[model samples]
Target: MAEINVTPFVDVMLVLLIIFMVTAPLLASGVPVDLPDSRANPIDQQPDQVTISIDPTGTIFIGNERVETGGLPDALAAIDRGQAGNEPVIVLRGDRTLQYARVMAVMGELNRAGFSSISLVTNSSQSAP
Candidate 1:
């Protein structure tokens, strides 16, 4: 009767840890995108970077925010100006089901916004040696 039972405490802690482990990865993935596989080596992720995602429908999203098609240029320009002098890398992710033209158009807009440090995100099919 004097002994303390710690079984309940350990069970609760284990459950919480498992929940966090399952959800942590989902947070970094952001929007759902079926990225195309590439054999090229993966690049190092930048500390200061912007994520632009284009879904299978060709809809564009800046980070998690959705922007109008006509407003993409201005949106990108605003981000560019907001950064002052620091040139942040732009990571573009387009669904593999999308047309090449759509991706090119987004790239063109990025270029127009004076962002030269742009990178394309792709799922690597093979590990780089």
Candidate 2:
């Protein structure tokens, strides 16, 4: 009686496992910042959605593009005008050290620029191990 060899199957599976292992870390999120913890749930399901990040240094970023405080309104307006809808959905990621007033001011600017679908980006406190 002759037995069929399964070495090829084992080799393919091992290769796939190695590939996944190598790419898994790359799939993780960007650099870790001191994200403001919250009890509120995040609404975004798509990873490619628009995001505006405010660093602790008061630097403003629109979809990863660094913009001056004066340019924020125009930057947001550009994003809004380029979108399919007038009211673009934006995720605001502010540092924990960011002042409440500054954050509110950003939100106000977004509202005045015609963005009604703004969502605050926060990681659930309960999610941390």
Candidate 3:
């Protein structure tokens, strides 16, 4: 009776597991921010949606490009022009350590730019015992 070889299969599985573990975090969108925990339901991600991230220091980013608060509206307008008539969803990713006002300021800009579909991104809250 011949025994089946399991060592190579186990090695391949281990390598794949490690690869996924390393890339999972990298798959998250926009700048790295410590998102606040919330009980809100997750929203469906849109392909044409725009991500604006606010880091701990209150720096704003459109995707990976840093943009000044003053320039945000114009930047958004440019994006609007590129997308033509379709209204792009705006997702705000703010650091948990940031003051509420800072986040609101960014939101204010988005509102002034006439972006009605805005969403705040947050980490899911863990269930209590």
Q: Whose lDDT is greatest here?
A: 1
lDDT of 2 by residue, 1-129 (tens): 999899999999999999999988555534334677777865745544577778888788876578886998888767734536544467788888889998898899988987777788776887653
Instruction: Give candidates' CA RMSD values in order.
Output: 2.9, 4.5, 3.7
Q: Per-residue lDDT for 1-129 in model 1, tens only?
A: 599999999999999999999999789767899999888777988777899999999999999988897999889977844456778999999999999999999999999889988899988887554
lDDT by residue (tens digit), candidate 3, 1-129: 999999999999999999999998787665889998898899998888899999999999998889975788788787753455678899899999999999999999899888888999998987742
Weakest ten-residue segment in model 1 by summed lDDT: 77-86
Task: Report the number of the highest-TM-score candidate.
Answer: 1
Against the hidden reference, what TM-scores do the models get?
A: 0.82, 0.69, 0.78
Q: List the residue pairs that clash in candidate 2.
A: none
- Model 3 quality (TM-score): 0.78
lDDT of each: 0.89, 0.75, 0.88
* Between candidates 2 and 3, the TM-score winner: 3
